[model samples]
Target: MAEARQLREYVPAEVPESAAPATIEDGDLTGGATDHTVWSCAGNLTAVRSVRARVRDFLARMGHSETVLDDAELAVSELATNALLHSRSGQSGGVMTLFIRSDGTRLRVAVADQGERAGEGGHSREDGDDFGRGKLIVDSCATRSGEYWSEATHVAWFEIEDPRPGLSLADTAL
Candidate 1:
């Protein structure tokens, strides 16, 4: 399993003291260079890879710098893969959705799935083998405000401030 850096340890400063929060209200929202796009896929694990690939292609086509595209795509993969592996619950119509957004100053990636994973706590790939706690990676890279939720539906997300000329991950690494 790939070692995920610890979230608390890699805290970035850009994360607000309260951690910025947002949502994907519906399925019809259109994303722009400074906005976001939401893509939903079925619970099958295969869909995770597909979502990652599509997101990467989309970012590349959008002309995002390689660094930004890779970070966003990695975050997408970790969240989507986790949704398929743990939150599916074998439900007939389970779906996993990815919300990608960039505010020019930062990028936010969110992954939501059909079932809740609250009681199980967050699982880590280091927890004895088959799965690694991908959230740790997300958290480490995300601003201090990044978070995860396991409500009736499972959702995990993270945010990274855009590392422009005057900004650095360290500056954002609260």
Candidate 2:
């Protein structure tokens, strides 16, 4: 596991409102409850796995459905990987921040990374296949998704609403 950076003073962030059902109220997804967390994620593959496992556990403890758990894990993995592969965060001593918030009904995840490196990014292995499909997977799974930049930080975020109990995720999508 990579060493996380020392914590910084906490400042709540807001994503622009969208058509999504759940919103982060001043970054409090639990509505004064207690389901929000921030992680100082090191830009590395190990952190990717840890982030996925942590997210799965977090949502699971909140009683989210398995499908929703799977989707959230997948989406976070992609965002973290993008930070590792496409931005300066993957460079030496680089770190990214992960924000997670959820109530029983809705969950939001975002990764903030140092913006793109000068002229260095991309995989060496390519055979005409899409090298990066992070956004595509997020688009399919999230109720709303978007990316933005603040200064030199790039933030990618996604939100999902749980399928009503007794309903499948596919059912809700329809």
lDDT, candidates in the order shown: 0.53, 0.70
| 4-68: candidate 1 lDDT, tens digit per residue | 12221222312233334553222222354432333334445777677778766765555555666
Tens-place lDDT digits, model 2, residues 11-91: 224554552234334454656123334454445678898878888887787777888888899999999888877887787
Q: Which stretches of candidate 1 lie over 4 Å from their true place?
A: 1-42, 117-127, 148-151, 165-174
Residue 166 Cα positional deviation in candidate 2, in Å, after optimal superposition: 9.3
Estimate the overall C-alpha local distance difference test score of candidate 1: 0.53
Residue 91 C-alpha lDDT in model 1: 37
Which portions of model 2 show Cα errors greater than 4 Å? 1-12, 16-43, 121-129, 163-174
What's the TM-score of every candidate structure? 0.59, 0.72
Error of 2 at 4 (Å): 7.4
Best model per lDDT: 2
